[model samples]
Target: MLISVIIPCYNSEKTIAEVVSLVIEEIGKMKGYESEIILVNDFSSDNTFDVIRDLCDKYSSVKGIDLTRNFGQHNVLMTALHYTKGDIIVGMDDDLQTHPSQIPILVRKLNEGYDLVYGKYPKKKQSFFRNLGSKFNDFTVRKLLKKPKGLVASSFWAARKLVRDEVIKCKNYNVHLQGLFLRTTKRICNVDIEHRERKVGKSGYTLRKLLRLWASCINFSIVPLRLSMLVGFIFASLGIISSLIIVIRKLVFNNIYLGWSSIMAALFLFFGVVLMVLGLIGEYIGRIFLCINNQPQFVIREMINVEEE
Candidate 1:
């Protein structure tokens, strides 16, 4: 079996070489499987492409794909999927947090009749904010994507070639890989893996980027829009009921008072609900516009050790 391991790199110049070497050594230990490493540079501002290019030149099995610009981690992975030619595809971050040695565990699960296997960390090695963000992400995935209970989505995972092909078939600009994974297969499992601290710089995901990723889920599911509609309906119903009560009190008992504070509170609450519903609808429309325009997922600027098929 040909095993293709894809690593999405940003400004990971410090750890790229060592990470590649470790992946090679780990895959080397598993005999009877020809290993190939595909390092995709997401237009890192550092010399990450140079390091990957050098590695590609040194090792025939190592390939380098230099993206035109930073398309985020998931988009980089999407582009890499088009080039993978293995029976099984393994994806992990450029950072060494996901140790290469843990890959075989995912592979073992995949071999036992699972289409996809995620490497779940017992204790994720991340900052408090990052962990919080991850929890929020998981929650959103469960609510919006209807993901199975207890299914953990991690960057380090193995998918059969069939899953990879289905994923690559997706052409929309806003790509949520976890959503796609859950939509594609129910035969998924997770293996516990040790998450190590980063050997290099911190994560490329800033607070803004993390929120952007979360917001992009609007393209994948309409649950957000539906929830917004439900909220609007509930608020509108409450408003009508309150207005009727006020009118009845004024007519029958003459006890209704047009208090400025109450009026202001009602205005603020209803306006907030309206603005929220508009924003959610706007997000869906915006994603549709981008998709209709055919936005290129990721532009490739250069490639090394990539054989033209």
Candidate 2:
């Protein structure tokens, strides 16, 4: 059996070489499995692509691709899927946080008739804000994608070529891998794995990026639109009831004053709700336009070690 391991590198020059070497060594120890390592440099502003080229020269099983720009992690992974030649594909980060030794566990779970398996880390080693973003992401996945209850989706995952093909067939510009995986199949499982501290630069996550990730989830799922409808209905009903109460008070009791403060408060509250709903709808429409315009998922600048014998 052939296994293709894909690592998405971004500003990971410090640890890319070591991480690739460790992954190769670990894959070598697994019996009856030939391995190919694909390193995708997502336009890193460092020597990450240079180190990957050297690794490709030293290791016949190593393959490398250089993207034109930073297309985000999921976009890079989706791009690498088309170049994989293994019967099974594995996805992981360039940092050593997801140890290569844990790969066998993910593969073992896949062997048990699962289409996909995620390596779960009970105690993550990320920063506080990063953890918070992850938690929010998990919550969003549960609500929007209807992911299995208590399933902690990590970056490290293994899947058969079937799932990989299905995931790559998704042609949307806004892609959420977990959402795609969940939409693809329910025959998924998870195994606990160790999470190590970063040995190089910090994570690429920022407040803006995390919010964008959440927005991607919204783009793929109609839950947000549905929730907006619910909110709109509730607010509309409340406004009607409030207006009725005001009218009844004015008719039953004389000299009732609905002052300017109350009027301005009502106006502000209603307009805020309206604007929020409009923004949500506009996001969906905007993504649709981008997709219709055929936005490229990623542009390849260079490729190396792809023709290994």
TM-scores, in order shown?
A: 0.97, 0.97
After superposition, candidate 2 runs with Cα above 4 Å error? 307-309
The candidate scoring highest on lDDT is: 2
RMSD (Å) per prediction = 1.2, 1.5
Candidate 2 lDDT tens digits, 1-309: 999999999988889888888888888899999899999999999999999899999999999999998899889999888899999999999899998888999999899999999999989998787788788888878998888888888899999999988888889877789888888999998899899998877888778887887778875579988999999999999999999999999999989898999999999998999999999889888898999999989989899977633
Q: In model 2, what lDDT does residue 15 have? A: 95
Task: State the displacement of the C-alpha of residue 245, model 1, in Å, after optimal TM-score superposition.
Answer: 2.0
- Range of the 10 consecutive residues with the lowest summed lDDT in candidate 1: 213-222
- Can you write out model 1's per-residue Cα lDDT over 62-132, one digit (the tens) per residue? 99999988898889999888899999999999889999989878888899999999999989888887888
TM-score of 1: 0.97
Error of 1 at 171 (Å): 1.0
Stretches off by above 4 angstroms in model 1 are none
